[model samples]
Target: MSWLQLKIDTTKAQAPVLEELLETLGAAAVLMEDSADQPLLEPPPGATPLWDATRVIGIFTVDSEMDAIIEFLEAQLGEQLPAHRVEVLEDKDWVRAWMDHYHPMRFGDRLWVVPSWTPPPQPDAVNLLLDPGLAFGTGTHPTTALCMEWLDSLDLQGKTVIDYGCGSGILAVAALLLGAKEAWCVDNDPQALTATRNNAEHNGVGERVHVFMPDDMPDMQADVIVANILAGPLAMLAPVMAAHSHASTHIALSGIIRPQVDELREVYGEWFDMDGLAIKEDWCRLSGTRRA
Candidate 1:
């Protein structure tokens, strides 16, 4: 089937209204993206943030009356429609298209993050079978990749790992696949916890993988603790992270940009002997051992 894609460039204030209007006009789906390459800071819990310049896209059946929809939208706004375009979008297997581009990615020499649909390039290497879903961390982003590479370098055999902000449970599951005794995944989002659990099970390490929310996380020390979250939250959770660490525990923290390195170093240094600063593109990963 063919569809009509309506793309509109508008202010953040107008984006939500446009989405609602498009839905009212029988759009099958609506998506909003940043028109400008703006960096988005973490929003307060339960808040949704949008960029100053937003591009709103609406998908509708090709046979829909686009002219009537546009007229109604403009009449509702009491102004002419902003810069927009409508194009025919031929139907394609979007999932297959995505999988075609997302090939198996190797982190370090031995660890491979492979899509569930694809075969591992190195069958003997540590392979993490994953599919990008509702949660993040399929080992594609620089931040996640940096953390995965660091995990690859470690001797995780018989170790207990804690993955704070565990999106999709990639790090925790990878640790298990690499011979870790157990992995505990903690995230604030319920969806993330679900994704983590599902991914862990998909890799056949379900019994060894535990999922928890931040508030419900148990008070237990781990041999290794890895957190891939924004610098701000990383800083704020320093005490919580420290509470879960004992002397000589290895810790890896990513989701930091180059500019935020010094502050994070200072914050995490109090609990751990922070040292290794790995840079990938504009992102940085910090690693250290827990202080006595």
Candidate 2:
């Protein structure tokens, strides 16, 4: 079955209305993206921020009435339609097409993030079977990769790990596969917690992995802690992270850019003996050990 993809360029303020209108007009799916190369910074908690210049695309069946939909949209907005175009999308195995672009990506020497459909290039390596999903973290982003690499370097055997802001539970699962005895995965989003649990089960570490929301996280110090979230949250959560660490407990923080390093270091440095910064592209990762 072919699809009709209608693309409309508009401001972020108007994108939502357009999206809802298209959905009401029998659109199967809607996707909104940055029309301009604008950098979106960390949004406030529970906010789904969009770029100033947005491009909203609505997908409908090939037989859908494009003219009627446009007329309705224009009528609703009380003005002429914005810059827009329609294209025919040929049907194919989209999952396979997406999977083809992602092969096994090695983080450090032994840690590899492989898609579930593909076999690991090196069977001896500690392979993490993950795919792109509703939640984040597949070792593709620089922040996630840095955390995974740090995990790979550690001798996690018999140690307890805490993956705060755990998305997809990649870090916790990696720690377990790297020989950690147990892992605690925490996230604010329910979907993230669900994804974490599912990923842990898929990686054969469900029995050893625990998932929780921030408010409900139990009081337990971990041997190692990793938080791959934005710099702002990392700074704010320093006290919480410190509470979950004891003397000499290893910690790694990422999702930071270059300019935000000093402030975060100052915040976390109050409890952790800061280590050298790791940089990949424009992203940065910070690691340290907790002080007594």
State the lDDT at 35 in candidate 2.
Answer: 60
Q: What does candidate 2's lDDT look like per residue over 1-292, in tens digits?
A: 7888898989978987898898899887776657653222223223445667888888888999898899999999999999999988887433444465567899888899889888899999999998765467767677888999899999999999999988779999999999999999999887689879999899999999999999999999999999988988888899999999999999999899999999999999999998869999888989999998
lDDT, candidate 2, equals 0.85
Stretches of candidate 1 above 4 Å error? Answer: 1-94
Cα-based lDDT at residue 277, candidate 2:
91
Give per-model TM-scores. Answer: 0.71, 0.72
RMSD of 1: 6.4
Identify the runs in model 2 with alpha carbons over 4 angstroms from their true place: 1-91
**Angstrom error at residue 62, model 2:** 16
How far off is residue 123 in model 1, in Å?
Answer: 1.0
TM-score of 1: 0.71
**Per-model C-alpha lDDT, please?**
0.85, 0.85
